[model samples]
Target: MGPTLATRLADWIDELGLTDHLAAAGLPSFTRDASGAPSWIEADGEPLSDERLAELDASLRDHGDDPAHGVPVALVLLARKARLRAELLATPAWTYDHLAEVRGASLNATRFWVHKQAEEHHLLTVAQGEHLLVPAFQLTPSGDVRPELLPVLEPLLAAGTDPWDAWIWLTQPAGLLGGDVPERLAADPEEAALVAHAATRLAQRVTASPKPRPRPAPSPVPPASGGCGCGGHH
Candidate 1:
């Protein structure tokens, strides 16, 4: 039998050197009960019961003004780390609801946490539309390509044909186009060579195209005007 998802994630976390962060946050390295549900060890070496963990999980969903009401900031950070690790191992395309269902968390909270981590790592793009959490390589009004597609597109584009055309042509069956260029090329070696040559030319054109400049970073927000606000103020 294959390893469980949580175990795979734990291995990835260790590989990424995130276990120390979890330790600093006073959470266990990673533990699995007989039922395979993951739980964290407390600072005192006692295992946190599922019921208690569920309570802490619920607390994170509450947006109360009282900072004391939610889970510890550190725990939240560790949870984000775990979620990121899980995402990295997941298939290229997964929606926010999909991840929430996997992690057993509220959709809103899961979306916020996943987006925040994704932004920090720049691992993937997140888009929200019609109340769905969409993960893609490029964020667009319609939808983004799966993260895995970017690498495929990049190499295909660099080789000289329009990436989209290459994508469709390469993926389509040999005879599906009937007597069209692709179909004819598939039927003859000489024609296939010519088609490959044409693809190279297109890739050259795509590679020669100038890339757009990146946008500037946003300015930092100013502090509130109420005299430093906290009790540390004079």
Candidate 2:
């Protein structure tokens, strides 16, 4: 079994070079108990004792459907997502006008067609604070839609995978690709069929899962109407 969170927390405290702080705070050196769990955060030798960890894990699982179940953990998760979103948006992207130019479509008509493609799951769209973005990974350097992307995106999009989640899946290493990242693998003609199969299997798993859908967070402000200024046509 993997290290328990209690154990991992102790390791993180050390890994982050916080052991000195813990020492300064008059706490004993961080160490694992007999079962490899951390010697509890307080109470001398048992803060997150096995019983407490079990209780906490059970509580989390029991209220997994509740957004407010674990406020601190949820906040940490949101912070991590925000970081990922920022990094993803920092990459090259395309605007409707740009895509239209690449496809020889009417510049003025791009907004309509691009939105339509998004609806059909033929395109991926990310809505940031005040903008919509099409991360450029989906396009060739010459700005045409990458052929390998289409077939793989078909099943994933059809399965209702969230755009952000789809991007994460595509960018992460896949066992089916022998540790090759999916988006990177897309550039290889020899691996096209393999990537497509992996995406299909991913979609199948997504469709088959019985997990409860997360409650959508309400956006405090309306999304900006115009798309990204990516093409420099703004």
The best candidate in terms of TM-score: 2
- Residue by residue across 88-182, what tens digits does model 1's lDDT show? 33424457766565556888987786666444432243232343333332332233333333433344444544323453444433333343544
Error of 1 at 210 (Å): 2.7
Off by over 4 Å in 1: 1-165, 171-184, 212-216, 224-234
- Report the error of model 1 at residue 154, Å: 12
53-113: candidate 2 lDDT, tens digit per residue: 5554454335356633433333344445556666776777677766777667886677776
**Candidate 2 segments whose C-alpha is farther than 4 A from its true place:** 1-80, 97-106, 211-234
Best-fitting candidate, scored by lDDT: 2
Model 1 quality (TM-score): 0.23
Clashing pairs in 2: 40-47
